[model samples]
Target chain A: HVTEAVHEYSIAHSTPLPEVVEQHRARSIDFANRVGMDPGMMVNTLQAQFMLFLAKLIGAKKVLEVGTFTGYSALAWAEAIKGQEGAKLVCCDIPGPHTEFAKATLLEAGFLNKLVTFFEGDGVETLQSLPVDQFDIIFLDANKDGYLPALKTILSRNLLSARGIVVADNALKQGLVADATDKNPHAANSNPGGVMGYEHIDEFNKFVRDNEQLEQVLLPAFDGLNIIRLKQ
Target chain B: HVTEAVHEYSIAHSTPLPEVVEQHRARSIDFANRVGMDPGMMVNTLQAQFMLFLAKLIGAKKVLEVGTFTGYSALAWAEAIKGQEGAKLVCCDIPGPHTEFAKATLLEAGFLNKLVTFFEGDGVETLQSLPVDQFDIIFLDANKDGYLPALKTILSRNLLSARGIVVADNALKQGLVADATDKNPHAANSNPGGVMGYEHIDEFNKFVRDNEQLEQVLLPAFDGLNIIRLKQ
Candidate 1:
């Protein structure tokens, strides 16, 4: 009965913390509205806070964020690494309205020195310019389509610390990833956007499974966050 | 088009590395068959590997496991903490056929002292016997109904390290969780067992939300694993 209860508890209340995050979406939403930018459907604040806490727990000093929409995620990370000696956050983003807002807010947060590097322009190019094995923690919130490329680039350049952990946003498209390949008779409508199309998260899940360089778990919080830790 | 390919690739690949243990699974399966067991569960293998890797990466020395089914999970933690002096594992279980097998294997693996201690009989009672602040990692794979109670006992007793990690398995229940709660009509039959009474996971998830002392992530891997790390 008790074992059954535990299983029941899990099924009944799966997204425990995310519900609170859903309630606390005001700050991010307001910030997005004022800056005339969308939050790019990324991680929620509570989720961001938890991640930053994880980064600090692991003693992360040098961090990399591929996208900088209003700098919320960047600020969360900066808060953790702020007072540490030689701590820094390297943010990559093309010049945009949100990037401008992010720059101002992060500066006001007094994290400018600790979270100041900006790789303006193409993320792939910017990632290439960085020295090898530099970042202790990397956040992949860039173009969803670029998730694999950016990851390959990071791996090839040896940008991640041997113990580095990377978190990718929106790895699952709602429940769209439930079906492995969706090749049934209704497969066409099942996958409206085709194999590599937009309205799907299967491709991403498969990529994570196929890659033999890292270990990852997909969390169903704030759309779907993939928590990946580099094995090497 | 290139972006689409990138997107598809992102889902198609990830950072998981080749596991050295996969090659041995068939052998393990044969051993299990000869010894009369299910070779454990495939999902549990993935969960065990992931948890062991994390524990090692975090420099965990003291660990606790609630279940000792065939000693597979215990072996995982042992492997991670093998070389470290003073590293230990505390396992709680009722005497079973797998118990003898576990003892022989662990002792043969040269973990006689390191792999010391197994509390037979009531697991909850055995857990209470551990000295406070003694564990850096705790794995919950015992009786399902005991999850919440075990969580309370471990946290209350302070057996967990200050910066410790707790991973609870089988929280997803083959997607049956939603049915018990009636959150989604589509997922109505998910929870055939009503033991999920009072929406336990929701209560747990919400507890994590308001509690700033811990950072948690619920991952959908091998039925579902909830990772809770103490915040500091």
Candidate 2:
């Protein structure tokens, strides 16, 4: 029944930063491990750092994260939005056993006051029912099959800002997208919701190409991330 | 002497649209048969289509083109903006023997009205002195050496709208950028322009990476095109 977080790697590896930023990232990972939550979905350190760097460069203040497993991915985005004027994150996820651990970690990291709203409900319904027109940036790391539907809902709601950037994680699926039409053995066979929507990365590529409003490029970072933007 | 622009290879056998677009692209290639100036620089028809499609999708109205060799690029952009509610293009290029021919072609194509404006002058100077700051999109295909300077000028002028996208052509340079530090064979002759100011494509890649306010991806289509947007 231990809930304490740990940092296995030394801070010596990272460049100078506010000690608090580095501490939170490590602590966030520890919380996930403590709860038996899989940290496997988190972006690799280099790619995470780069994404944070990009968010900082863009001065992102409002962020939307579609998945919150153990709070590792959420922390990466939250940290990037830090130091900006009035930054906040809206994290969406269905209620799970790990929610308490994630909430505790966010509080411990002093991010509660930063408006990290945690809504416990059906993620798709939550996203569709949300009342908003634009968000500064959005990150997707939830159910793989929900990407397109989530995107459609977000765009329809105008929940993405005019200059907003959208990042979709697990796009490469361990090189599954190299040939989009083929099936991936790694995809979970059990459909928890009675629906399977595993995406072939190539199909997503086609999705981007066919979607005139989005200009997308797939970066083979970590598991692969699709960086997209409003076409303007 | 009839100065007719002809592709010795029969047009029936070629992808004429791309050839037409490339004719708009600027290069010092001496055509074996040049009837009337260079019939605009051959624009990469596909690339032009890409940019134009993006422009329309974003509802871009004001566009500025840094180079108008033969006006093929200008025409492609114009074609995209033509049917829109109110879109216009301001093209900058020094007047030369080819300007007259380009003008005729644009007019014949029915793109000469208010949609296209030709500015005969040093493109860099024009870009620097332009009075406006809210361009929906900007295309850079001017002097190769001027690439960096033109980019700086564009960034300094703040001509790009928040949702604006800037596409720079000739980014790959036959893969010379694969080793950007090495001197390019094309620039070895000590041409004053120095291969459009960058010895290799790597320099441009570095430029894009170093800038904090923009996100750029190099696409391998028609030589190479760099698609960029403000970081946010």
TM-score of chain B of each: 0.75, 0.75
**Could you estimate the TM-score for every candidate?**
0.71, 0.58
- Candidate 2's residue-wise lDDT over B117-208, tens digit each? 77789888888887866777888887777777777888888888887777777766544444233344443433333655445344565677
Question: Candidate 1, which segments miss by more than 4 Å at Cα?
Answer: A1-40, A44-50, A130-133, A144-158, A168-232, B1-43, B104-116, B131-133, B171-213, B220-222
Give the DockQ (2 decimals) of all models: 0.23, 0.04
C-alpha DockQ for predicted model 1: 0.23
Instruction: Specify the highest-lDDT model's number.
Output: 1
Give, for candidate 2 chain B, the lowest lDDT window spanning 10 residues: B1-10
